[model samples]
Structures are given as C-alpha cells and as structure tokens.
Target: METTILTKKDVEKILTMEDTIKAVEHAFEMHGKGLTQMPPKVYLNFDKGDLRAMPAYLEGKAGVKWVNSHPENPKIGLPTVMALLIYNDPETGFPLAVMDAMHITNMRTGAAGGIAAKYLARKNSKVFGFVGCGTQAYTQFMALSMIFKIEEVKAYDINEGNAKKFIEFCESKGVDAKIRGIEEVCDCDVLTTTTPSKKPVVKEEWVSNGMHINAIGADAPGKQELDEKILLRSKIIVDDLEQALHSGEINVAISKGILEESSIHATLGEIIVGKKPGRLSDDEITIFDSTGLAIQDISTASIVYKRAAESDMGIKIKFFDF
Candidate 1:
C-alpha cells in the first residue's frame, strides 16, 4: 500500500486560517449534533512531559493525533509541543496519510478560539490581549484577526524578548501591537491565555465586563490560568464536558470543590448547534475553556489531505506488502 507523507512545510503551504475555521466549525457542529465519535483523550505522564493520544471519526474521516508537551524543551532549544497525525480510511481501515501535526494543532486551537469569539464575544470587540507569545499565540492572533477587525494587540510573556517578537510580528500585520504587563494585557476586550501555568496568573479583578476569554493553556490536569472568581462570575463554556471538567481551565477549580459541573453554562458545540445560548447580555463576561478535540484534528487533517492531493504535494511511499 502507498501512503502519502507530508512535511510541516508542505502542509503549511496549503493550509489557510479561513479554511481551517470553517472546517473546525463544522467539526463542532457535528460534535454538537452527535454525528461524530471521539473518544476521550488518553494521556501518559512523565516526570517532565506528557503524551496524549487523541482519536476520532467524523464525516467519513478517521484519524489519531499523538502529541507531547515538554515544558523544559525550550531551555534546550526545542519546541515545548510536537505532534504527529495519522489519517485512515474509515471504511476499509487502511492508513492513508501521515503528516506533521504541530501546525494543525495550533491552527485548530486558534480556530476554536475564533469560533468561540464569534458566538460569544461582543460584536464590538477590537482589542486583543495575548498571554504567552508562542507559536500558538500567533495562530490565535491570526484566527481572531480573520474574524474581528482588531485595532490593537497587547502581549505578555514570561520572556520579554519572546513577547517583543510577537508584538513586532503583529505590528507587521498592520495591527498596533505592544508588549504590556500581564495585568494590563488582561484588561483587553478579548483575553487569551496560552501559558503553561499550574497556578492562576490572571487575577479576578483584572477582567472587565463583556470580556471574552479564551483559556487555552489548561489542557492537562492541575493546569489553570484564571482565578476561580473569574469562572464564578463568567458564563463558562467548554469544548467537552468530561474532558474539560477533568483537564480544562476549570479542572483545578472543580477539584477544589468550589466550582460545580452544573454551573457551566454550555459547551462551545452546544452554542454552535443552538441548543444553548451564547452571550445573554452585553455586560456578561464569557469564557471558553478550550480542551482541544480529536474531531478537530480529523476534520482539519481531512482538509489538508485534500488540498495536498489536489496540489500534488508530499511524497508517496509504499510501506506495506499486501
């Protein structure tokens, strides 16, 4: 059997944030309507890193993403997150393509944030605040910019140099971008936290009314970004109930017995499917706790595979003797 192998650059050449947004939105709709099958993500923890296996089947596509997060890698000049995606033929149970998934993860996560903003953020939101100026932060900015006419960007990172680089990139994109203190960044119209912090770095008082927050960092158990008071006062939305309750931003709060499962207003999928409301009032603060979904990976992979095929990108290798 012949399988297509695509590199990161090959996949990046054909992927667009706008297309990814549509694909991820459809994935959410399918997930919300119960048309997709995605098992809960399974994890294997290490002393300093963790690996996750996320598998799903949706709209005739099947795939799995094996990804890892090593917080200390940056000190050694490596990325903190790396991923590999495998696509399969759902009908024949045959392997189709193997591709680099780091970019896909960034794009889909950013797409989820943008979709959440579309449904939850106030229409007039113009200022965007990004915490943690990494590759994921760039994608989040790109995706949000695709949806909103962002006028200014405020960035903060543990490494001031990294934050300054992100600001320069954003400024080159024609947005007024500046590196700011953490508390100052939290005061924007939309705040996205992507730092790998176990403790809450954003205080409750910094958040203002009508602010929409994309809590992107807490994808593992014990990781949290926002104070419990922020969740208590906001209309909390999650990507998946079981996953988010266990690993998303609310996980720490739930474990402390301060937040209840019933207090969660709705899942992002529920809002997309119109089962639950999004933002009720103009002054209501909304938070989208994003635990990345496998359906998102599968759906996004399907698009990349299609585009690659049409453009004749990547290498075809024979790996099986049948």
Candidate 2:
C-alpha cells in the first residue's frame, strides 16, 4: 500500500473557498442522487465532554473520513474540533492518504453554508449577521462574502474579543462590514449562528422577514443557538432528517414540540436537485440546519489526494501487509 501524507499547510496551498463550494455542491448532488452511504454517528459520552465517530463511503468515490467535534478544546490551547481524513484505494480498499481534517472540516462546513444560501437566502440580501465569530466563522464569512453581493456585515460573539477579531478579519478580507454586539441581528438579511452555547442566543423576535438563518453551532443534543420560536416560525431545512434528528439544531426544536419532523421542508440536497423549490418568496423566513456530513470529507480528501498524486507532493509510505 502507498500512503500520501498532507498536513494543514498543504491543505492551505491546495483548497480554496471556491474549491470547497464546488466540492460541497458535488457532494450534495451525489447525495440527492443517492450515491453515498453513511451510518448514524456513534456517540461516546462523558460529563464534561463527548466524542463522535462518523464514517461514510460514496460508491465510485475513492476515500473516507473520520471526524469529531469538541467545543471545549480552546481552553487548553487546542482547536475546539478536529478531524482526520483517510483516503483508500478502490481496487484493494487499502489506505492511500492520511491528511489533516481541519481544513476539510472548515471548508466543507463553509461550503455547505454557501450552497444553502444559493438556494434559500433572499435573492436581494445585503446585510448579514454572524452570531459566533471563531475560526469556522471566518470561513463561513469567506464563503458567503463570495456568493452574495453583500453590502455590509454585522457580527457578535459571546466573547467580545472574538467579535472584534472577526470584524478585523472581515475588514482585512475587504468586507465593508461592521462588528457590534449580539444585538446586531436586527440588521441582517441573512444570519448565521456558529457558537456552542447551551442557551439560546438567537431569539425569535430577533428574526425578520426575508431573512435566512444558518444554524451551524448546535451539533450535540443539548447545544443550541436559536430559540425554539425562531425555528417554529421558519421554513426549516436540514442536511439529513436522521442526522438532524439526533445531532443538529432540529433535535432541540423537535424535542420541544415547537417543530415536528413533519415541519421540515426538505434536505438542502433536495432543494439542490429539481425535486423541491427553495426560497419561494421574498418575505419568507428560512433556516438551514447543518449537522455536517461525511460526504464532505470524502469529496475534500479526493481533491487533495488527486492533487498530491499528480504533483507527487506528499511522502509515500509502503505497507508490506494489511
């Protein structure tokens, strides 16, 4: 077996926001066509922390990935989440590449947001509000800033320092936006909540007509970013019903009976395909529940794996046996 190694910096040289957007769209198309298989996430529980193992394969696709989410790692000088992507040979099912998963995670997650916005956000959206400003938030900004002809951005994080930092970063990217406290939601045509707060940070009344909300922060059962009322009032969309049921923001809404599984409109994939309509009106409130997906990993790894192979950029390791 020959193995290719890719680090975080390699990922930087290889993938861009545009690449990720294309990759995610392709994954969504494959998903809509039923070309992928993924098991429900397996959870390992603890008092202060929890872990999940997500594995998946897409027929004819050449790689797989395993990723985890942990929001408390920053206190220890580590990232809040990490992932590992393992590419495999189709012929022998042998490992082909092992690479840092953070780049894939950040890019794919941001790409998912862009895809959702392409379908669901108001056509004339101008101002955006960001509820959490972390590293992931930066990419989320990068994705949307490219897709939408955004006029201004308003952002807030529970941590004032982070919010300020987000503003500076956005400015460095040439975004004509403002950084303010959490109260900036009133000015948004699109809103994104990307924090792991246990309590609701986005209130129902804070949402306005014609606004699209991306629920990105709440991946675990008890974590939530929006008030149930916010979910109840919107036409909710999820990546997958089963994944949303257990891991996304939809789980909270369902548990509270503010939303039933019946209330969900469609998977973003369904909207991507011609099967369902997205953002039918200019004044509708829409929400996209992002639990994250395994296909994203496969697609991203395939991109890097191919590039490394063509350029012979990574170290190749040989394994004599399985």
Candidate 3:
C-alpha cells in the first residue's frame, strides 16, 4: 500500500477558509448528533511546554494529530505551536497519508470561532476586537470577516510591534484597524482573545452587554485569559464539555469553585445541531471556550487529502506490499 506524503505547501494549496469552515461545521454537527468518536487529548507535560495526542473518527474518516505548544519557542526561532497529522482508513486501519497540520490547526480553530459567532453573536455585529495580535489573530480575523461586514477592528498586544504589524496586515486587507488598549478592545461587539496568559488579562468590567467572545488562548490547565466574573455572567458554550472543563478558559474558575460544570449553557455542537439555543436575547453575553478539537483536524485534512489526490499533488511511496 502507498501512503501519500503531503508537505505544508501541498496542504496549503488545497485548503481554503471557506471549505475549512464548511468541513468544521459538518464535524460539529456529527459530533452533536453523537456520530463521531473523539478521545480526550492525552498530554505529555514538559518544563518548557507540552505535547498533545489527538485522535478522532468522523463518519468514515479517521486520523491522529501529534501537536506541540511551546510559548517560548519564538525566542528560539520556532512557532509557539506546530503539528503533524497521520490520516488513516478506519475500515482497515491503513495509513493513507501523512501531512503537516499547522495550517489545518489555525484555519479550523478560526473556523470554530466564526461558527460560534454565527450562532452566538448578534446578527448586526460589526466591530471586532482582538486581544492578541499574533498569527492566530490573523486567521480569526479572516474567519470573522467572512461572516460579518466588519466596519472596524480594535487590536491590543503587550508588544506594540506585534499590534502594529497586525494593524498593517488588517489595513492591507482593506479593513480599518487600530491599536487600542485592552479595555477599549473589549468594548467591541465581538471580542476574540488569543493571549497565552496564565492569569486573567481581560477584566469583567471592560466587557459590555450583547458581546460575543471567542476565548481561544486557554487550552491548557491553569492558562486563563478572561476574568472569572465574566464567565459567571455570560452564557458559556464550549467545544467539548470534558476538555473545556479540564483545560479551557473556564478551567481555573472551575478549579477555584468560582464556576460549576452545571453552569455551562451548552457545547457549540449542541447549538449547531439545534439541541440547544444560542444567544437568546440581544442583551445576553455569550462566550465560546475553544480548546481545539481532533475532529476539526481530521475533517479539514480529509478535504486536503481528497483535493491533493485528485490533482496528484503529494508524493506517494509504497511502504508495504499488499
């Protein structure tokens, strides 16, 4: 049997944000209907960072992603997060392809945030806020722009250079953007937080009514970006209940007894599949706690694999004689 080797370039050529959002939405629908299998992420802790093993089966597609998160990597000329995925045939457990998952991760994570906003944010939301102006923030902007008619973007970062660079990127995209204080950023119609802060960086008082927040940074235990009080007042939805409770934005709050599992409104999937409601009123505050999902990677990978196979884009090598 031959296994296709797909490089980052190969995958990038085939994947698009539009297609990614569709694929991820389907994955969530399947998940809400109890049609997919995704095991809780297994983590290998390290002094500098951590690695995660994510495995999932959606419909007839299956895959495992080996990913790492090292916040200090950039100082050493590496990305804060990098990943690779092995796609397999569930029927025979055959390794069908191996591909880079960095873009897949970023796109799908952004797609999730967009999908969350679709159901949770007010339909007239036009002002977007970003608390972390890094690579992830770019994708988040891409996804949100596709969904809303964005009028302005408010960006904030501890590093002024990063925020300025992000503003330039936004301006090139023809969107009005400016660097703003964290409090000012939080005043937008929709707020996206991507900081890797261990403690709260966005306070409760800064967040206003009818705002939808995509809490993207806290994917590990003890890592939190928003104040616990914000969670207490918002209608909280998570990507995965178990994973969110363990390592998402609400983890610290839950551990500290400031929040309860029973307080969770619903999973994003539940809202997508109509099992629950999203943003009941214009005055309601909502938050989506995203920890990143394995099904998202697999689903996006499936699209990349299929498109690459049709175009004969990746290298194929026979690993075993059938």
Report lDDT (CA) for all predictions: 0.94, 0.82, 0.94
Ten-residue region with minimum lDDT total, candidate 1: 34-43
> After superposing candidate 2, which stretches have Cα over 4 Å from the reference?
46-48, 69-72
- In candidate 1 the C-alpha lDDT for residue 180 amounts to 90
lDDT per residue (tens digit) for residues 1-322 in model 2? 5788888888877887887888788888778877778777777877656666667777656665655555577888877667778877777888888888888888899989888988999878889889989877888888998899877889887688898888898888777767676766555888988988878888777778889999998877888888888777789989988989887998877887778888899989888887788888888999999989988878877887777777778777776564
Q: Which window of ten consecutive residues has the lowest lDDT sum in model 2?
A: 60-69
Error of 2 at 26 (Å): 0.8
Task: Return whichever of 2 and 3 wins on lDDT.
Answer: 3
Q: Rank the candidates by TM-score, best first.
A: 3, 1, 2
Give stretches of model 3 more than 4 Å off.
none
For residue 95, model 2's alpha carbon misses the true position, in angstroms, by: 1.1
Candidate 2 residue-wise lDDT at 102? 85
What TM-score does prediction 3 earn? Answer: 0.97
